[model samples]
Target: MIKYLGRDDNGIRKVVLNLFLTGDKFTTGEVYDFLDKGNFEVSYRGVSAMVGLMNTRLGILSINVTGDHNVYSLKESYKNIVGSVLENY
Candidate 1:
């Protein structure tokens, strides 16, 4: 988890992870829009990369490809772990 999150994330990763804690599936575009609305200074590609890393490296998100987008949600088994980690982080 530490490897995936890195040692010095300025709460951006945590904010992104908190979106998943809502238990709703979201495409990268949706995530980007959410972050943008929240005034987070992140690009769409950056959000895509972060979501990709969460799916591939962290093995925490379950992804479903819909058309050209990949909709992602936090896996049920990792919910508690993710929530606790975010809380403590």
Candidate 2:
């Protein structure tokens, strides 16, 4: 498991990870909007960067390019791990 999963950022990272629990694909903009609607005060770029890190560093999310935007989804293999981490977070 990634050490950074829920270790910092006032639990913002954990909230972001929980977003993937739905098993739906989302672009950065969509993620930002969801967070905003949920009262999470984070920049759109922050969400983008976090998602990027989950893709490149954490290696937990898979990406799909659609038109000009990148869509992200939790990798099937990491779903359980993510769930467990969140459960214990």
Candidate 3:
């Protein structure tokens, strides 16, 4: 967790925004896998926990759960962040 948010919230949000900027469909588990491949060393369970926090506490991300898993996407203005850092955003 970075001291800015003091709760790892910003880091989690950044991860989500980065994935969404990839402009590809990703399931929760797949997203976890994608992030886990990175240098940050976070786990699938950790990603799941952050997703829950984003959904319930921050309300920055919206989700749709169907069949076997849930898909997560963000709300507005968060696009600003995605646009600044992403390639295809």
Candidate 4:
């Protein structure tokens, strides 16, 4: 359900892992923009859903909801674990 982007796990995980590699906090829109640059062609809704799943299901990210924005970043404590997940993906 990576941001409900139609269950494209491989693509969604690639976007998430790439974003994680940056080691910076980013909003859902920022992620969407990055995905566009990577030619993922995903919608804002999809990015939003992906973020939620990444945080809740995968436990690889930490989310900060500030007013109307949700900023996400890799969970520092889970860095190695996330790296392993991505590597094995």
TM-score of each: 0.90, 0.90, 0.63, 0.78
In lDDT terms, how accurate is model 3?
0.63
**Which digits, one per residue and each the tens of the lDDT, describe model 1 over residues 27-79?**
99999999899888999989999899999988999999989989999999999
The candidate that achieves the highest lDDT relative to the unseen native structure: 1
TM-score of 3: 0.63
Could you give candidate 3's per-residue lDDT for residues 1-89 as a string of tens digits? 12223444436556665676555545668878777676567778877887777667756566788888888776565656546644332
Clashes of 4: 3
Worst ten in a row by lDDT for model 2:
1-10
Between candidates 1 and 3, the one scoring higher on lDDT is 1
lDDT of 3 at 59: 62
The TM-score between candidate 2 and the true structure equals: 0.90
Q: Count the backbone clashes (under 3 Å) in each candidate.
A: 0, 0, 0, 3
Q: What would the per-residue lDDT of candidate 2 be over residues 1-89, giving only the tens digit for each residue?
A: 45896366577788788888775999999989988998988898888998999899989999999899999999999999899988886
Q: Against the true structure, whose TM-score is highest?
A: 1
User: For all the candidates, what are their Cα RMSDs to the real structure?
Assistant: 1.4, 1.4, 4.8, 3.7
Error of 3 at 68 (Å): 1.4
Alpha carbon deviation, residue 89, candidate 2 (Å): 1.6
Arranged by TM-score, best first? 1, 2, 4, 3
Q: Residue 59 CA error for candidate 1 (Å)?
A: 0.4
